[model samples]
Target: MQKTERLVAITVLLQARGKMTAQRLSNILGVSTRTIYRDIITLSLAHVPVSMEYGPGGGYYLPDDYHLESAIFTREEAISLILSADISGNHNLFAGDTDLHHALVKLEAVLPEEYRIDVMAAREHILVDTSAWCNKTQEPTHLETIRAAVLNSYQLDVLFSDTSCCQVHPGAGMLWRRIEPHGLVFKGLSRRHARVGRWYLVAFCQRCRSFHTLRVSDIEQVYVHEETITPRPNFDLHDYWREARKQLEKLKPPIIFKLHVKAVARYSTLHGDVTILKEEPDGSAIVQVNAESMDDAISYALGLGADATVLDPPHVRMAVAQTAQAITKIYS
Candidate 1:
């Protein structure tokens, strides 16, 4: 690794546990003890607060509260950071002080003059069409609390709003669920179709008497429970979600539909699924998939908008028409 990269790595290692010997750092960085000392001085010159101790327990340490004020990046590194931030920004995932905009500002401030222009040019031209789905107001804080509980392997007593019914009773509506959070899954598509962009916290709900997928937004309040639920030894998050998706699919009646999608080269490159049935001579492709019910299939087609068309199962076309009429009645 380059000296600058090594410096960043060293800082991260020291910060992780707050202390490390020069010899240990030297071994980890594949440099000599003398090189480690020189790098420490270099870091200090760059305004990093590093302290050194002597004797048997001697080592280098950053104060517990020290924070990284700046970072060094190559042009490529800068672009990657900006693009990642841009993508996340599109998702409405960064609405607060901790968002991508802040990170970009810091990066631009510290970036070398030679690479600044390229970074700015890339930022100016790169565009991400995030889904229109907006995050729930309390999502960030709620996610953090749930994450902490999950990491600590603690049970959660959560007040949840069940959305299965059309109208909810005001006073007696709240349900308390004891959940053992397993993992988080960002399911469905973009934010615009937010009902589709459901962020689920997969958990074993004791009250439900089975595993459940709880929407993050549906959680009203959470209290960390005193008990910790032990996860099964063979539990794997990836396998769990795969099974969940399949089970969900099974619950819906199978509706076969075909779509002729006018695949935009640029857009397709980013979001297209090649695993679907067919690709045409032109850039356009035919897609074949099964939805739970006719209504579900029609909704999926509508989400694709004019870019796709229903080419099979003539009944699906009627179903789509009826759904459109029903939706239009609301506005009418």
Candidate 2:
């Protein structure tokens, strides 16, 4: 690569990979260690925060706060970036990052007129909404407070939504639980899906003496504390979420329901959690499904009309029968 490209590459590598030795940079850029050192000096002359450490784990690194002033992107890359910014729930994901907003505006201003038109056309064809259907999306009231506490390694005094009524009773500190904020988990989808994005505060609850995934919206009140606490040893957000989901599945096992399906065409409407046990000669099928409760099973059966019947689980079948009879009486 040319010297100018090599210099830019070095800057990007340091910024992306955090730290690298001269030998590693030389090996990556197919250049000599001397050339790598010269490139580092050139970047330093350009006011890049390139620093080095001398020790067993020493390497060349940019400061933690160092950021590139500007970036160059190809046509495809620019389109991808602009579309990502456009469809990121209109700044909902970033939680009102003014820097990001300004950066995007700058990027748009620099794009050529032709490229700008192409990007706008692409946006018109493709739209992504990350919210759940039926208006189930929840916005946390104490998101900023929890976010600050997590960033500063501070404890949070939280009142969970476990009371008898909708209002908090203004109880003593006995009711407020203290937690060491570990991280925040935003669970949501990108496509047109049913699962809406919900913010969850993962923390070590001192009262329970265990890790808890507290829903942000359900937190009635939160107070950030001056007392900072270190995170748990080797705490990983993705690993904790995976293990927590496994335990949750164990706690709430799927309720199986056996069903006799009549109209095969309507079978496509069934939920994804289904298993066909047997198929009859009359195009009927016996299937098993998982529901949360008997009421869910009844509703599922009723939705199919005469196309399906809840066979096993006597109570669900009885409930479906009673509901059908009541509906028939109303029609008569």
Candidate 3:
């Protein structure tokens, strides 16, 4: 590894642990012990708090309060960091507000003149129109506290808002919930919409004895306990999510209905998953969809606007007619 890379690697290693021997650093960095010593001195000169111990099993250590400064990142690294920070929802994972901001400033300072202009231009011109359903912002501190509790295998007293009701409630709402913090999953598409881009903590809920989806937004507060819980044996998060998706899909009845839609092109393109049974030359399309009930199917057809005409089971057409009558009554 290059001297610069080795320096960064050493810093990472020290942060993960408190100390590393010269031999271990050499082996990890694929360099000679002498080179490692040289790099350590260089880092020390750069204000990296590096300490050396001398003994039979001596090694190098960084002080508990040691931190990397802004000079560590090159211009390219700085730009990447800024872009990442702009999109990162959990900014609190990094220590200190000033640390992240200072890093961003350093990155901007070193950005290539042309690249900086291009980035500014892209930001100015790009317009992202998100849908109304978007996820809410989660407080970084709350998420971190919950994560720490999960990591330490401790139970948490959480103040949570139940989605079933629109009010916030406080207490040790869910108790003695042993959780093995598996991971966090980002769900939804858009960040701007209230229900879009929400984050969920995916953990094994000991109280329910099942996997529970807790929205980050619903978590009002988290209090960590001293207890720990053992993780499920051979728990595969990937398979768990796959099965979860399937179960959710099964809950929604299949869309099955027949529609003679006038805007054939528009309807087919939008509801292509619903089989197109036939088509007419006058720009009309005959489509069939399998749904759990007539009400559900008709409601879906209505969403297609005036372009759609239901030609299915008699009961479904009658339901649609009744809906139209109800609308006419209100208007008239």
Candidate 4:
């Protein structure tokens, strides 16, 4: 590769990897260790914060918050980026990032007149709207506050919504809880839940003292502690999420109930991973699904209109009957 490209590559490498030894950088870049050292000097000369550690265990590193506004993208990459950004919920995914809009505007402004047409043409033909129907998409409150707590590692005092509070006394206030902010998990099209592009706060609850996952929509108010917090030992985001789901299963045992579905087409409303156990000759299916709770299971059965029937978990059947009676009484 060219020296200029190599320099850009080195900057990107350090930016991504956070730190790398000269030997390791050389191996990755297919250059001599001497060349790596020279490149480091070049980066430092260019005002990149390239720091070195003496002795063993450390080599070259950048500051924890070092970020360069500059980036290089190819013609196709630039077009793809524009198209993708256009569909990112009108730049709402970034929460409070005005820079995202600024960067996009700058990128478009600098593109050649001919290249601008290409981007606009692609967007005209291809629509990428991913909003859920029925206005079920939740507008989470206090996202900026919650996000800041996550970044600064501050404890959050959250007024989280609870089912008991909602049902028992509608006028009652929300429950107060303290969560040690870990990070925010934003859902995209990749996740199967009906509610797409929702934010989830994954943190360690002071009450539970373990890990907790609460939907940001469910959190009414968030009060952040200015004092920064130290994260727990061996806290891996992916691992914690995986284990949290497992714990959720124990607390609210998975309802492995069968459903009789008459829909000839696959129902998009059926959220999350589901297993199709059997298919009848008549375009109907008897499938097994996992719901978080009995109430959810009943809702699933009811949502199918007459097309679905819950075959197991007799309590769900009873609940369905009671709900139907209540509805009938209201309409009667």
Best by lDDT: 2
Clash totals, every prediction: 7, 0, 15, 0
Winner of 1 and 3 under TM-score: 1
The best-first sequence of candidates by TM-score reads: 4, 2, 1, 3
Q: Which residues of candidate 2, in runs, are more than 4 Å off? A: 1-77, 90-93, 111-115, 129-136, 140-144, 161-174, 187-199, 207-209, 258-308, 312-332
Per-residue lDDT of model 2, residues 5-59, tens digit only: 5675676667667778875676455565678889888888888889999887789
Runs of candidate 3 exceeding 4 Å displacement: 1-109, 133-201, 207-233, 264-279, 287-300, 312-332
Clashing pairs in 1: 131-191, 131-192, 132-191, 132-192, 133-191, 133-192, 253-292
Among all windows of 10 consecutive residues in model 3, the one with the lowest summed lDDT is 161-170
> Any idea what lDDT model 4 has?
0.67
Model 3 root mean square deviation, Cα atoms: 10.9
Estimated TM-score per prediction?
Answer: 0.53, 0.58, 0.47, 0.63
lDDT of 4 by residue, 192-245 (tens): 433355677787766656666887878877788876666464675666667766
RMSD of each: 10.0, 10.2, 10.9, 9.4
lDDT of 4 at 173: 59
Candidate 1 Cα lDDT to native: 0.66
* Cα-based lDDT for every prediction: 0.66, 0.70, 0.59, 0.67
For candidate 3, the lDDT comes to 0.59
lDDT of 3 by residue, 82-130 (tens): 5544544343333232443443544455556765776576557654432
- Kindly provide the TM-score of model 1 when superposed on the true structure, using C-alpha atoms: 0.53
